[model samples]
Target chain A: MAPILEARHLSKRFRIPSVKRSTVREHVLGMLRPSSTEELVVLDDVSFSVERGETLGIMGRNGCGKSTLLKILSGIYMPDTGEVIARGPITPILELGVGWNPELDAIDNILLLGSVMGMSLKELRQATDEILAFAELERFANMKLQHYSSGMASRLAYAVAFRAVREILILDEIFAVGDAGFRERCESRFRELHSSGHTAIVVSHDPRTIKTFCDRALLVDRGHVVVQGDGLTVADAYTALLTHEPAAAAPTAALPEAVPAS
Target chain B: MADAPTRRHHWGGLVWTLVRTDFKARYHGTVGGFVWALLKPFTMFLVLLGVFSFIFASDPVYKRNLLLGLFLWDFFAEGTKVGIISMHQKGYLLTKTRFPSWIVVVTSASNAVITLAVFTVAIVGFLALTGRTPSPVELVLYLAYLVAALLIVAGISLAGSVLFLRYRDLNQVWDVVTQAGFFVAPIIYPLNILPERFHFYLYLWPPTAIIQFSRAVLVQHDIPTLRAHLMLLGMTAVVFTAGAAIYRRFAPRAVEYI
Candidate 1:
């Protein structure tokens, strides 16, 4: 199948300035002085694509640039050098509750968040009932988001994503939201999305969801994709790397593409 | 969705929508709620007028005219003060989605306009009550002042909003300027009363010219000569041009900082 999204040679580098202070006084006086600089290469020549109706997962440890890749793909942050082509209406659920207003009630936040997501007020009203019901937040719909537990906010956020007419769903480790009961609900909603042949890109550390929900996986070490092919092989490679032993040099030995040209 | 071709230059409507959301959120809680946008400024005008006229042995003509100038100046000062926080206030929206960055500045400036609309009623009503009826020409002059003032304030505020996102020192400086400007911008003093040497430079402040124009049309009942109107309008355009150039160039970087 033709790819719905493609990223090529994407690289993001960030400068973190530091002071080369000669004395403690200079370090303290840097507030009134200038400083030197350092740099971090967050994503180096990373590239991938997602086919229509396919679920792809990104698995990495913290600070492994998984979130940075997601941000670049979502168009939140432009890469230092690269380009992205998205085919359809892409919804990037990066940190589900980021759009919420603490002072506004759940209902008001629903409208506000939905509006930013490109839904009109009239259209949001139509979807409101389904969203609230799906979130199981009937009673707390009028409560301020700050008052709700983090889990409750997650449920509402999920409801918003599921109800939308999404062509590409970008998930940033959303499975860890809410309690066990809410997790079960999230699993069902996710399954419902996948079974309908929907397109999704999930960035997560959780092994189970990546294995169960995603048809393929990309394992990132530092800023490079060390392994990319099938889900099980990628998962095993990722786990092995974390175990401190050398990961399999060829995680996807079975896939013909994994073998070096002979 | 497939189409013949989608235009890339359709962010104006989206910017407008965000501006509307900002106006709603601004006056969300109050005694009269959003209506106070008009009432609060007018109340300040009346109280200032009362203090100057009733307590101080000030001339009635200058006092009333000065009140008119204060009304116009208040709009400019308060508009920019609130606008300086436009990007910072909407960090939640800015950090998440990547829409046109100018939406925050436009929204904040437009919200100030909503309050200015309220202050306007107080201005006209107070003028009518004071028995200073305006001729049609004078009425046109008042509107011209409002147009110029809004343009200048919107421009300055847009630039200021983006700047305030990075350096917060400007926030305190702005408050002090407005506090001092309320007295210095010919809001409470008469430019005609000052020497002719200061008169030309007094118009250097676009807002001062706007406030003086509003008073000339409303309280003085004089149809400012065409030259006066043209001068004010030209300066208004320049102020807006500078503001727009600064905002468009630098406002996009604000999202990165946020």
Candidate 2:
């Protein structure tokens, strides 16, 4: 099958300015001196692809470009030297409730958040009751979001997002939100999406989630993908790396096929 | 899907929705709600009335002119103040979504417009109570000046909002500038009190021209000279164009800083 999404030679660098050139005097003085900026390479020549109806798990240690890769794939950030060819509409739940207004009521936020995530107004209006019911927020629909707890807010966000899922979805640590019950609901939703043949790029640190849900996976470290293969190999490598165990300690020897290094 | 709704919608509906939410959210928890919007200008009017009413007790028209001037000045001052920080205030929207950034600034300024509209009703009611109804042409001229003032303020606000993102000191500088502007513009005092040489400077600042031209037509029942009208239009165009240019150049990259 043809790939649904492909990122080629993806790289991104964030610049850290050492000087404060806010004032006119400092601005001129800084121009006279050598430029003082340190570049942090967050993603370095990392490339990957996800086929149609595929679940690709992205695992990495903190600050290892997992979220940045997701952002680049979602077109929130322009890669310094790379291209992402995506075949279908992509919904990125990078940060749940990122665009929510705390002062607005739950129903109003539903409209705002749904439209912002690319759902049509008609669709949102039609799905309002279902979304509110899914979040268990029907009672608080008229109340402002500020009155809702963080977990409740995320639940509402997830509900809206779940209703708006299309052919391609990029979830960056979204499954970690809410309580155990909501997480279970989310897991079931993931299963539903899986059965429906939706292509997904899921970034999570949970080994079980990867092992159970992902068809294939990639483990990134320090802006580079170090392992790529079926879910078990990549999950085991990630677990072994986290536990300070060597590659041989991860049942790599017992497995006849070795995971490919990306 | 790769063909997601990246295409910008006809954003009029969205902008209006945002504006309504912004306006409503501000007063959601407050006891006064929208009355707070009117409270500031009315309180200022009372204080100014106490200070200047005695001095111009013999001339009721001077008192009316001063109040009108204060109302217009308040609109310009409050609009630009909110507008300059509008982009920063909506930083979440900017970094998270790909909507047009200028609408953020416009929405912020529109909050001031809502307050101005409320005060206008009071002013119109007051004029009717005092049996001094403005001619339809005068009202039209005054409305024109009011619009020019809003555009000029919005233009300056757009430029300031973008530049202020990179330069944190601008808020302090703007506070000083607007305070200085409050004194220079004919708000509490009439333009006739200033020396002839400064009249040119006043005309150059679009807000000042707007305040004076509006007062001339609405309060004094006098038509503005053709030169005065031309000056307001010219300054409005220049400031608006400059603001749009600044916004276009810096707004796209502004999300990175936020």
Candidate 3:
């Protein structure tokens, strides 16, 4: 089968005005002066694809455009130059608890965030008990989110998001939080998803996660893909790059291009 | 392209959830809960009625007309007022997820819609208490004009929501506009109090036309001319189309500015 998702030469550039003009008076006065804008290229001709039932890991330094690339793939940001072709619906957990209202209780938040993640109300209502159990917040289900600890909130966010996953899941730094037991549960759930043939694209800084969970991985530096190989090899390359230079420098010499999945 | 299915699947549920959450949050802690929605317009109506009663008391239908006009204006004013700030208030959701941006504006205006519905029922009740029941034809005509008013609100909101993201002071500007509009739209006084030439200019504003047309049909028992009906429809179409176009063009880049 053809790749489930593909990014063809995707590029994104954001224009930063020299001075912020957020009011009508400033905007009108701005017309009298010469306009100055600086364009920042967040993504530069990046290309990749994910096959059915495959887990792809994107490892990049801070501000290397991993999030931007994921935003484009998830349809949150429009690319300036290229296009993303997605054969399946994409559920992006770009951040946990994105729409969570602290004023609402756990059940209310599950309904709100679940719908935001593309789950129907019926499905959310049916799984509310299961979600609370998963998050280990059954006792605090009716308590307002404001009263819950940050960890509890993260767990609820993850539980609802996990249940709302569709044909393709795009997660950004999902494992950066949560306790040891919750992390273990998430790993087992991810394993179950992988075995069940759910395609996913995960972005993380941890090489162990990429090596242990990803089928293939790409190392990105300064908006360009530096290398693509098996999980372990690419993970090792990332670790070496990090050790050599804490801050990402110029892109290294060309390495192997992405190998098409058989 | 690939996200279309997910968006389409979640559109209705998402809109409903947002609107419901908004209502709950606004009223959840209050003792009266949903009663607050009705109480706002009614209190405003009572206050305005007392303040202007002596000036317009000569007119037999002044009370009913004032209540009706207040409800219509409240919908337009409150809807656009909240709708304009909705994009900025919901900016977090926009940046973090992928859904049609217009849903935010629609959800914001929904509170006004509900308030208007409840206020309309109150108006009918007040009419009955005063021993002047509106005819079915008049009621239907009034509803049509209310819908036209809603269209105008939706149009303003669509453009305002996005524009407000760029211009932070838009909400304050809208507040001043709405405050000025209450007097300009013939809500408290009869249209006949103004000169005939000024009447035409007033009718040019969509809200004036809506309020006048509704008063004519429902309270004054006077049917408006077909030309008046066509004018309201034309104005509604223009405002709604332009708003939708502006929203479509600017909403995509709204997140960048926000």
Give the number of the best model, judged by lDDT: 3
Error of 3 at B40 (Å): 2.8
- Winner of 2 and 3 under lDDT: 3
| Fraction of native contacts (fnat) of each candidate | 0.14, 0.17, 0.47
**What DockQ do you compute for every candidate structure?**
0.25, 0.20, 0.53
Off by over 4 Å in 3: A245-262, B1-3, B6-10, B29-31
Over 4 Å off in model 1, which ranges?
A: A19-32, A195-197, A248-262, B1-43, B54-60, B126-141
lDDT of 3 by residue, A1-262 (tens): 8998999988776666678788887888888886666666667778889999999999988987899888888888777778888888787877665556788888888887788777888888899999998888999998998888878887887787778887788888867768888898888888888899899999999998998999998988877888888898778878878887543344653332332211
The stretch of ten residues in a row with the least summed lDDT in candidate 3 chain B is B1-10
Q: Tell me which residue pairs clash in candidate 3.
A: none
Off by over 4 Å in 2: A1-8, A19-35, A49-53, A83-89, A97-99, A120-122, A194-197, A228-230, A243-262, B1-13, B29-31, B54-60, B128-132, B225-227
How far in Å is the alpha carbon of A22 misplaced in model 2?
A: 6.3
Q: What is the interface RMSD of each candidate, in Å?
A: 7.0, 4.0, 2.5
Candidate number that wins on lDDT, 1 or 3: 3
Model 1 agreement with the true structure over B164-240: per-residue lDDT tens digits: 76666567778887787776677655676678888887788777788777777777677678898788878988989
